[model samples]
Target chain A: MDQFTLNLIVVGATFALYFGIAIWARAGSTAEFYAAGGGVHPIANGMATGADWMSAASFISMAGIIAFGGYDTSAYLMGWTGGYVLLAMLLAPYLRKFGKFTVPEFVGDRFYSGTARVIAVICLLIISITYVIGQMSGVGVAFSRFLEVSNDTGLYIGAAVVFAYAVLGGMKGITYTQVAQYVVLIIAYTIPAIFISLNLTGNPIPGLGLFSNDTASGVPLLTTLNGMLADLGFASYTEQHDTTLNMFLFTMSLMIGTAGLPHVIVRFFTVPKVADARSSAGWALVFIALLYLTAPAVGAMARINLINTMYPNGVKETPVARADVPDWVANWEKTGLLKFDDKNGDGLINYTSSAETNELDVNKDIIVLANPEIAQLPSWVIALVAAGGLAAALSTAAGLLMAISSAVSHDLIKGQLNPGISEKGELLAARVSMAVAIGVATWLGLNPPGFAAQTVALAFGLAASSIFPVLMMGIFSKRINSKGAISGMLVGLIFTVVYIFLHKGWFFIASTASYSDSAPMLFGIKSTAIGSIGALLNFAVAFIVSNATEDTPAEVQELVESIRIPKGAGAATGH
Target chain B: MADKSSSNAYWKANIRAIQIFLVIWFVCSFGFGILLRPMLAGIKIGGTDLGFWFAQQGSILVFLVIIFAYAAKMNKLDREHGVEE
Candidate 1:
């Protein structure tokens, strides 16, 4: 059979599986809609969280970023996974114990303030919406490439699929579907890495393969890669080029941000016990680590493969004739992700670090998607990759949609707008909000703003700077009153947003920025790394405001004390 | 359920444990993986040094261990404090 048929069959099969799970797991109540009826097994919840957490960026773009960025991008690996540490220790268990349903519910109840809850709802909306746009766009890209459709058509299909599952089944359906997605995405991710690793280093395990000898050169894979890159005027593969402070802060931001993200935190609420919440985080990391560990190896190997393919004989030898370029290059060039201009009219493809002399311009996003094709992997494997990418995008989109809709329906509409709304009415509201959220995400994906690229940093920054600190302070400090929480969130939100806008154009409009990232306004700290500073400011501000204001209510103090321990958690369920 | 003082002690113990683990977490990722990396460059691993290993793989593995260890310890604390559900 042809590749297109295989692609359709594999992708279709995965969709069928997801739809089946969604039908089997349709949510019957608000409790199930919001927290999977608070009875999810720890391991299953962990798997669902893994799928929820690893977005299209993790599946399609992260390895590519690591491949090109080399050691500098380790921040993403450590930052993303390390946040689970913070979640497991500092956030997850306590939240699970305190949990009724949504994150804003905690903020509202813990602070004893409607304003704080509304602020949290706003922050949750901004973060989830911005984050979901990227996932929607990723779905479009995957569909366009594999299914041979326009980007718009791809996005619409993706939106429809997400709408069907998310709106119908809510968290329960999303949870089970996410488990299947985790399996698909991980298998799809690791199988290619395994094959590539064995080919490059004679090791089947890609993580260890990275440290093993390259089969061709009889030296460490990284060593060979570094030597080749250096010979080609590129930085060493294993050496750090970015500044220590920026890398440190960026990692810190991602860690906190990951811990703060509403969707990820809400996953813990699904588990039956606070103890399960803690261990579930560990299991989530184990599942996430499966992909994270394999990523660096895939990145390094793909880089080596690219150079080898281009050089054929060696880096010092004649480059491949333009006419003789690999079929993978042609295939990717058609997608406009890989370009060759044959500079100097020499008809030779010169892949190098020097910009002026380079004849190939490969988008970093294509590295993983094109890896199988580049290495001449079978058609079925490539088709599986397409399905995997879609699963990654769809699962994350569903999770983010869940967070968005719950914030609107549960936190905003039910909590504030109409406290008297019945459970059935609330469920209807949740589905409507979910559908609306997906529609907005689809529209944004179709007409992605110029800042679409910066949304990851923005989402992470807002979460790290605003949501995370407040949640932590809410749990860890009873002295913090509602006033303190509100002010801290606002200050952090404004500071991080302004800092980012100044560097990335005011509101992401190119002409309005007074400062550029190349010459940052403060201490050479890139806007991306400023979230940690914002977090610190938030912590400091909260302490100051709380000390100056009235102390927390006695009953609120009791609530804080209750969440710290893991007892009577079952009694804490549902409003 | 335990009385307030006993619960307070459990909370205190939990805080102490968290402090210790967070210190380890910071040391592994930010210290060995970044700032202290130059100091650990003398110790070689594969083609790169130990610091590179920490940045890429070692720190993640350490994070995994820390989380699971914390969970186990916290579970024990929960049971000892008579707080386990």
Candidate 2:
């Protein structure tokens, strides 16, 4: 069958499988809807968390980012994983012990004020919705490319499939479906990487292959990559190209952001006990590490392969003719991910830097998606990648939708607005909220306010500044009070938001509006890296605010004390 | 019993352990790879400096060690607290 047809069949079958599972495992209780009855085994919950955490960026864009950005981008590899340690130590077990239905619900109760809950809910909504739109866009992009449909048509199809899987099953269905997605995404990511790894370094493992020698050049792949990149007017591939301070801050930002994300935190709630919460995080890291560890290898090898393809005579050979370029080029060209203008009209594709800062601005998004084709791999592999990209996007979008809906129903509508709402009524409200969220996400994806990468970074920034500090202090320190938490989040949130807006926009300041991400950040720290600084400010502010105000209430002090110890954890569930 | 108590006390001593390891991890990844990189510019490792190693591989390896250590230590703490499952 044709590659497009094969893609439709494979992706379609996977969706059908997920849809079937959703139908078979439809939730029957409010408990099941929110936390999958809190009965999920640690391993199952871990796998589900992996699927939720990976998202479209991890599956589709990460390797590409690593490929082009080189060693400097290892921040992504480490920062994303490193946050789990923080989550495990300072956040997860305590939250599990507090054991509420939602993150904002815990915030509302712990702070003992509806205002705190409402503020927390707004933050949750902003972060979750922004993150979800990118996932929707990924779904549309993948579908249009592999299924030969228009982008809008593909988005609607993706939305419908996700609705079928998520609305009926809620948390229960989404969890298992995510577990399946993790398996699919990992397989799709790895198979191509393994093939490319063996071809380049004569090594089977992509992670190790990065450090091993390139058989073609008889030099280590990283060393060869660095040399080739430097020759092309780019920074050395394995060198510290960016400022060390910014790199440190950026990595720290992403780590805290990972810990604070509501959707990721909610996944831990589905597991049974405090220990399960801890173990599940460990397992989630194990599963997530599989992708993260492979990513650098994939990026390095892909970079090497792309260079080899363009410079058949090793940086001196004439590039292949644009028109007669291979079928792989033709296929990706349709997706607008790979293009050729023949600026010099010599017909030979001049893929080199223009010798004056490379006016060729290739979007980094296409790197991982186009990896197989760059290496001249088969059509089926390309189609499978398309499916994998959809799996990543759809899985994350579903989880974000759950967080949003829960915020609306559990935190806003029922918890504060109508405390006496019946379980049946609450469940209905959740479904409606989910439907509305999906509609908004779909619309936003179609018209994306900014680039997908920028939007994801903003989501991380907001979470890092606003949510991480509150959650950590809520668990680790008994001194922090409502006033402290609120003031801290406000200061951190405003600082990070204003900094990002100063660079990104007044509100996601656009590049077209005479702003730049490279605008002189404080201490030469870029706007993106300042999120971690914002988090530190948040912690400091919380402490200062608490001491300046009244001591925490006796009940609140007792609550904090109890959450620290492991016993009575399951019973501490404020059911 | 002595061995178990020693392990338990080691586990309970949290500030020192987390502080020591986190400092090392931070120094390797953020400090060496990023901050002091200019200072370590001439110290080469496979055609690059120690800073470059931290950015690409050294920092990541250290992060892995930190997490595994944390997990191991926490597990021991649980047993000592008589909270082992």
Candidate 3:
């Protein structure tokens, strides 16, 4: 059978599985719609969170980013995973005990302020919407490449699939479907890494293979890679190039941001108990670590493979003739993601760090998707990658959509707009809002904003600076009044947005930026790393404002005390 | 139900434990991985040093252990405080 048939069959089979899970898990009530009826097993919730957390970026682009950035990019690895530590210890258990349908519900009730909730809803919407656009675009890219369709058609199909599951089943359906997605994405990610690891280091476990000896060079894999990169005028693979302060602050920002993300935090509310929330976080990390641990190995090995492919004999020897290049090169070249130019008219492709002399131009994003082909793996594996990328994108898009809809239907419409709305009416509203969210995400994805590439910084910066600090202060300190919470969130939100806009363009218009990232304005900290400072400002402002104001209400103090204990979580409270 | 005093103690104990674990978390990821990396570069692992290992794989593994261990300890504390459901 042809590759296209195999691609269709594999991708079709996965879609069928997701649809089956969605059909089986149709939600009937608001509780089921928002928090999976408040009875999800810890391990299942963990798996679902893993799938939700690891987006198309993690599956498709992370290894490539690490591959090219080398040691300077360890921030991505540590920052992403280390946040679960913050979640497990500082936030998850307490939030689970609070037992609310949405993050804004918790914020509103905890602070005893509608304004606080509204601010949270706004922050959640901005963060989730910006994040979801990337996932939608990823879905489009995967579909266009594998199914041979236009990007718009791919996005529409992706939006339709997400709409069907997310609207019909809500969080319950998304939770189960995400579990299946986790399995598909992890297996698809690991198999190629395992094959490559064995080929490179004679070790089957990719994580261990990274530290093991290179089978060809009889040295540590990293050592061999570092040597080759240095010889090619590239920075050493294992040496740090970025400043220490920026790395520290960047990692801190990502950690807090991960914990603050409403989509991730809401996953904890699905578990039955607070203790489950804690262990479930551990389980989620274990699953996430499975992919993360393999990523560096895949990255280092891919760099080596690319170098070897370019210099068939050795780096010092004659480069391969352009006409004699591998079929994988030709295949990828058609997509415009990889290009070969005979710069000196010698017809030999020169891959190097020097821009002027380089004859091969490669997009780092293609590293993971093209790995199997580059390594000469079978067509079935390539097809599985296509399915895996879709699963990663769809699962995250669904999770973000759930967060968006719940904030609108539960927090905004039910909590504020119409407190008397019936549960059935609320459910209908949730479905409608979910469909609308998906539609908006698809449209934004089709016509991605100028700042689409920097959405990560924006989403993380907002979450870290605004949402996380407020949530932490809400749970950890009873002195903080509604006024303090509102001001802190606004201050953090405004500071972060302005800082990012100043560096990235005013409202990301590209021409209105007051400063450039190459030369940052404050303490040598780039805008992406400014969230840590912004979070500090939030905490400080909250402390001062709350101290200056009257103490929290006695009832609100009791509410805070109640969330501290895990004894009476009961069922998640609805409006 | 536990009295208010003992419940407050349970909360205090939880805070203390979280503080200790967070210190360890900070040390592993930020300290060993970044700030103190140059100081610890003398200790080699594979082709890199202890700091690089911490930045890449070691700190992640430590994070896993810290989370599970904290959970177990918190669960036991919950039971001891008579707060477990």
- Note the DockQ of each predicted structure: 0.85, 0.29, 0.82
Q: Between candidates 2 and 3, name the one with more favorable TM-score.
A: 3
Instruction: Provide the clashing-pair count of each candidate structure.
Output: 0, 3, 0
- What lDDT is obtained when candidate 1 is compared to the true structure? 0.92
The positional error of residue A122 in candidate 3, measured at the CA in angstroms, is 0.7
Give the range of the ten consecutive residues with the poorest summed lDDT in model 1 chain A: A566-575
The residue-by-residue lDDT of candidate 2 on A121-215, one tens digit each, is 98899899889888888888887777878899999999998898788888999999999888888888888888898898888988778777888
**Deviation of model 2 at A558, angstroms:** 0.9
Please give, for residues A507-558, the per-residue lDDT of candidate 1 as tens digits.
7888989988788898778999999999999999999999999999999999
Candidate 2, residue A500: Cα displacement in angstroms equals 1.1
lDDT of candidate 3 over A87-192, digit per residue (tens) = 9988999999888889999899989999999999999999999999999999999998999999999999998888888999999999999999999999999999
Once fitted onto the true fold, the runs of candidate 3 whose alpha carbons sit more than 4 angstroms away are: none
Candidate 3 chain A: worst-modelled 10 consecutive residues by lDDT: A566-575
Write model 3 residue lDDT over B1-85, tens digit each, in one string.
Answer: 5689989999999999999999999999998999999999999888889998888898999999999999999999999999998
Candidate 1: the clashing residue pairs are none
lDDT of candidate 3? 0.92
Kindly list the per-residue Cα lDDT of model 1 for residues B1-85, writing each as its tens digit: 5689989999999999999999999999999999999999999888999988898899999999999999999989988989888
TM-score of each: 0.99, 0.93, 0.99
TM-score of model 1 vs. true structure = 0.99
